[model samples]
Target: MSSFQNDTAHFAGLTEKQTATARLLAEGFTAKEIAARLTISESAATKRIEALRQKFGGITKNELARLAREEFSGSPSSHTVKVFEKNRDFSRAPDGEKLTWKNFDLPNTDGFRNSMPRNRPETELNFSDGFTLDATPPWRARREERLVPEVLDGEHAAPARWAYVVGAAIGMAILLLVLLAVADALGNLA
Candidate 1:
């Protein structure tokens, strides 16, 4: 028997639909193509693929395919896949009327008292006294004074400063030499 057939034999409990989906996926068919072939929605095909991934304890489609192939081919895999029960109660919302910020007591920071949205109570949105909305750009404000390190602001910086000066002087000299060479070549041509 082919490896794929052998692998499928090991997973005999798979539903007919799951088996068909897996076969198509193993054959490199995209979810859209599989959906069309199976007469199902693309989202349904994607969900099937995700379900297969979860069943095989695979984080990726490729891993899921490998797991399927290994299981079908009678190869023993080290990882054990766990099945989880779906929780219906987790999807339920709390049983109560919707509560807005107006229902709670909050302090207003800004002097403007009427900034709350229409129909909402004044206590809905409150800013603390420490909060200040400055219209000016943050960068334009006076910055805290910082002390400069001696290496950067004192005689310790002389060596680096001199190095920059010497480097600039050398670059200028090279530029002048190149210009002079060009001028000499033009003069020779004339």
Candidate 2:
């Protein structure tokens, strides 16, 4: 087993950004090395590492480094995945087929808030309109699988509650009763 595997407590509370710094650091990276890996400024890496240490309440740089190596694999964590999934707005295509990424949100990112991020994976899953049907790898198989569920999920979004139907029926009955009362009043006046 890796020496790092047993030291999980030292790496607790490392955020996504810190995990990145830690992975580079574990490979004997300098602050500049960490920055280069993430395409950020050296001071950005340094300050981020500092902030990470503070968040974890580490008393020394070594302690911070220890935590980062323990927790930071330089990729999104399970919790991060959950956050992103929760933020994404899923829908069937307007035609109720074709699982599309045409205008799909990226879950929790600010990019998703303003607009959908591009599906720019190295395999070139994009179509002519900058959309991708590649939810999983090997696009054709996944695309076809999406068709039935897309239609059904969209159809299911329409209200299926008994309460809504009952409420509508009650509302219609009340409106008819009001009309009948008005007609009776007019007849007495005539």
Candidate 3:
């Protein structure tokens, strides 16, 4: 058999579609390319790749491809190849033998009919415990609670205050120099 067919022979447990997906993946096809080539949706192709990952003991795509090539190339002592061969015999149990919820009681349909109040009279509205019917707005009620007030007031203000001080000092220095120059000119005029 050709190498591709021989490589795929190790994945006998997979469905035909899954087998095709594994082959395409081993051939270095992207999920989008696999989808287009197999006439399946991209999501379906992605799911097939994910299933292949799981079936091969959660190895990556590159590792899976390498394992496939090694197996096909007749490397008989590969542990991963043995795992693939062992997974083939794991047939699912019959439906009747499987655990299901058939014996559980069906839920009561009428139990939720009046669970919530519907159109109660406004006069009958009383606040429950831990609840308030008061008309006070949230912002007014919690006006004392400031978010990050320390960071806003202390940390941010320090740099701004230093900048203002430096700017004021520079302004004063420039004003003093201008005054000195004007006094020197007035003395020269005299």
Candidate 4:
């Protein structure tokens, strides 16, 4: 809202190339050299410098140089410090991490047992051939086991039920004979 807010806010709106030019200009680079360093046309670089001057209220080259070191020149708030702080941390990581592969973690195969590319001194891998199998078997099994007993299926349950009833009858007859013998001995003693 105020006329003299921080200028770094506008710097945020500038393209990456503009930011690079500001940085180079601050570092004592000429327009031509800045263009060569960035692989851009000199005129384009010059235009960017002119644009930088306009953004800082028509500042001359010296004033532009001054503004390059300034924290905020374009709008109000200075974000350059924050941006550089972030970039300083980001550059230490691998390029794959900085780019589209930020989620990729470096491989740490410390506990992996089945690591590939086995380095055998004698055997070599055949590319076209399939992988080699590494299985072994004993000559014969030591223990002998009989087949499982045949289960009485639903249809055969009727015949099995009669056998169970016969077994129950035999058990009851033996029990009754014992009880009768005990009663006869008691009767004789009376």
> What TM-score against the true fold does each predicted structure earn?
0.32, 0.30, 0.34, 0.35
Model 1 lDDT, full chain set:
0.63
- Global local distance difference test of model 4: 0.65
lDDT of 4 by residue, 1-190 (tens): 1133445666667788888998888777888999999999999999999998777666456545655655434422233222112233444755422322134577778746576646755456445646765554577544556442334335676777777779899999999999999999999998
Across 1-190, the per-residue lDDT of candidate 1 in tens digits comes to: 1112233343566788888887787666889999999999999999999887665444457545545555545545413432222322323423321111122446775645657555666677675787687577866846566564555567668886777679999999999999999999999997
Give the per-residue lDDT digits (tens) of candidate 2, residues 1-190.
1122223544554567776677777666888888888999999999987876565444346544533443455433311211112233446323322222255445666646676546556676744866667356664454344544443356554454444578889999999999999999999998
- RMSD (CA, Å), each prediction: 22.0, 28.0, 18.0, 19.1
* Candidate 4 RMSD to the real structure: 19.1
Candidate 3 achieves a global lDDT of: 0.65
Any residue pairs clashing in model 1, and if so which? Answer: 6-72, 7-72, 7-73, 8-72
Task: Put down candidate 3 lDDT per residue, 90-183, tens digits, no spaces.
Answer: 2364542222223366779698685776768889988678865767776664656665446436767787677777999999999999999999
Q: Give Cα distance to truth, residue 73, candidate 3, Å.
A: 5.8
Query: Largest TM-score belongs to which candidate?
Result: 4
TM-score of 4: 0.35
